[model samples]
Target: MYNDLSNEELFGPSDYSETSDSESNNEVSPCSFNEPINNISYTTFPSISGLILYENLLSHKQQNELINGIVEANYFDNPESNQAMCFGTLPSFLLNAIEIISRVPGLFPDEIQNREPLFDQACSIINLYKPGEGIASHVDLPRFEDGIVVISLLSSCVMQFKPLSVIEQGDDNNDNASYYNKFKDIQNTDEPIPIILRPGSVLALSGSSRYNWTHGIEENEIDEAGDEKIIRNIRVSVTLRKMKQDQLLLNKDDSNSFSLEVKKREH
Candidate 1:
């Protein structure tokens, strides 16, 4: 199921370069990276509310370091079509990355900071997608809190988002079909919006985007972004989320059962 696309075919020839660091850089705090760059472009899709994209949020060096850390981390073959690594507790090496992401201006709700107890249980997942591999469309379970941050590394690809109402119509149960039938006319007209996630970039989905829409990447070696055909690479995504404590308790007997349920759904 793997595509044998050469590095040259995917990214052309690599141009390696190195630069000296300036003394001014040493004075800048690591958290400063979270501040928005004036030149960086961002967009929020009209179709998918609360979906935000920040281009080139991380530096090339930071991206390389994070990728290396993930590679060295324990990862297992995910039944959902890619390799997966889950972290219940943030590791020391990834603390810097987490700090940078946490400090991202205007990304999280103000109440998020006050919910430190729940945030302390914050977990992360690293999904490694090789060429021709991608996730199917689905919304995250409600066991996760409202805010979801995903940092893209190593490559660029298009992620598509569609409304939940449309997806429910496809369910096998008659109750779901009946509930969705009223919107069948409108559902047929709804189209998935494609968002191109670049390497070292960040995408945050909250509010309506987190609860009402389904997002996934299409399985392909190359993705169409406007006129450019962006070739896929070993795309790694770091997803950070806080656990919904109430939902966690209500959903299963305990944390272990909840974990098992998650694994079962993936398979």
Candidate 2:
């Protein structure tokens, strides 16, 4: 069904704005949170730059509301789509989630005061995953700028990140089997950094972490997190990004070729 839709149609609108009159031009305080929120923990990976995780960012009630909204909206009604996207303004249910993310100090830059504190032009991609289904290692589309944010819901899983060199030696056709093999082949010298993403956690990627690393999940019903094994369940990830101005109208194939150009440039 989305085949006939333009990129603008796939997303809400290309000119969509996240800024509001009330938030416009107001200087945000450095300490946005008045009191320390319980169960909140911030972490970073030394091996990967600009990789940040904010655990327990949403409470149980808030997480439930978001999950309920996504399900009720039928964003993934078509079994084939798997992914749904929203641009500009967000649904009413997600307004509070974005507000909370915006308050995280230095999570998003304040130089762009006219737009939303989070991103210049915000877009969200909602992805649904069934048990045992996992994504392959790949860099995010270069059409999107840095500062990729992902919010996990409903289950816990390990996301593995490897350097671009690992992917650069693989086939461009994106054969998942070969990719997985390559992932396992470098365990000793270049072990992939595994990050545990639990429900209600937010992961942000930027700089080298965003461009020079490939992240993916292995296909398995159970995942190893630390010394414990986590059983996979129905999970949803909401990824937020700032779209590049010129790439708004690119079709799927165009985006793929553009990604190739990015990879070539990295070499």
Candidate 3:
């Protein structure tokens, strides 16, 4: 759906764009960063019900540019977690990447389009993970729309997902207590499945996989990949999400108010 020639006009020319004949040829190479990840090459993790993985979704050059762009931008510390993060609207430089990601066929549930505009107002977060740093196992809050995409850069790490039912049940009156207790019997029998997230790779969590499971990375300096122990480097994750309906309504109201103020001033 994206016209490469029109990209320059719409979002301005990005340094990561393919500009030469040689670079264009490299786009078809599996190892090249210019190559786009499509459904034919996409794979789903059988172990985790709805976890989809796209290898090399961003080329090496693109990955480097994304990392550099986020680094050059402002990032705030996350007060709720150990990992420092910043949340804001996506920058223009990153729009090209978002357009590319939006074109990935069958990336979301069919109902996603009916519920809201996908990527209309792109919201994103840049998370910085240091050596031995990782997030706890938790489900994404319901405030975000269904599909959650995370692009990994700089290092490869193992992400583990476990069914939320496996957690110990708390107060019975708690809203989610019943949901958690329903699978309590399966807790001992169920094992957390690990997925290796390499640099330039994209991980899409949706449907049951997004709500029913808790995902996290172990706080280890190194991750074991097959027989190799991959040392952890400073990694950055750029997560893209859509705001829920209520949030969208608030934004619409705020926009209308600003427009009214501007019109009054002009009159």
Candidate 4:
């Protein structure tokens, strides 16, 4: 029903580090992206944050290309977890993204120079929504967590966040179990904060959205003017972040060793 965005690099590939088996330190966590929802400010439901992207990330042509089935060879792969590293082949974009993300306040200074230059190669992720397959509105867990840089590719879609109430958000006591639970009836809630996104748009939302609120893509339809009539468009976004494993790989990223917070799941 929508268009996919694709782009060739304005900037070229980057100088990333190579690691042997035991070199876990330089390896950034490949967010397997499972457990798609979690605890947070909006208990009954996740609060709302609008869509965000950098104007310079992608050129117009690169941003509005036709999206078809992505070739499997293009992404990072983990056979065991059925995940691919979407960012692996595109070190140039990933590196540029790191420079952008480091400017955010929460991203520590040391973390940027050491880890960002090496730890994170790129992000690898894919989102598929059927006629009925859609996400309920919810906040992302662990606010202000990673040094995040996200790029959007594929079909355009609507993502929304519902308004939160005083009674809705509970105290954040830094507890794991509490945050793990999903409270609000996220499946089609109300008071939404909404935005539509296009391909080639890059969003640096981790500094804010990951913790403060909940957001989701609404079930939608598509209409094409080209050869195709209507097809449920797929969206593939690559999110780059400075996580615990990234810091560990580059010892200079932090004064202390990497803490085991929000570790990457198997991929």
Candidate that would win on TM-score: 1
Residues 82-195, candidate 3: write the lDDT tens digits: 232223344654665676667566667777633445654435655666678876665665566778888887776778778765343222232334433343344444677767
Model 1: CA > 4 A from native:
1-41, 74-81, 117-122, 166-189, 247-267
> What's the candidate order when arranged by decreasing lDDT?
2, 1, 3, 4
Per-candidate total of colliding backbone pairs: 0, 0, 1, 17
Q: Which portions of model 4 show Cα errors greater than 4 Å?
A: 1-51, 60-124, 128-132, 143-147, 164-190, 206-208, 222-232, 244-267
Residue-level lDDT tens digits of model 1 in 168-241: 53443324234334333444346777777777668888888887777878889999866667788777788877
In angstroms, the error of model 4 at 216 is: 0.9
Q: Pick the candidate with the highest lDDT.
A: 2
Question: On residues 59-178, what C-alpha lDDT tens digit does candidate 2 reach at each position?
Answer: 555666777888887776766556666655567666666666666665533452224445523457777777787777766766676777888877778888887674454243344345
Tally clashes: model 1: 0
Q: Is candidate 1 or candidate 4 better by lDDT?
A: 1
Model 4 C-alpha lDDT per residue in residues 114-219, reported as the tens digit of each score? 4534334433344444333345555443332344545556544555545544454544544434544453443434555544444554554543355445565655
Model 3 RMSD in angstroms:
11.8
lDDT of each: 0.60, 0.62, 0.57, 0.39
- Give the Å shift of residue 56 in candidate 4: 6.5
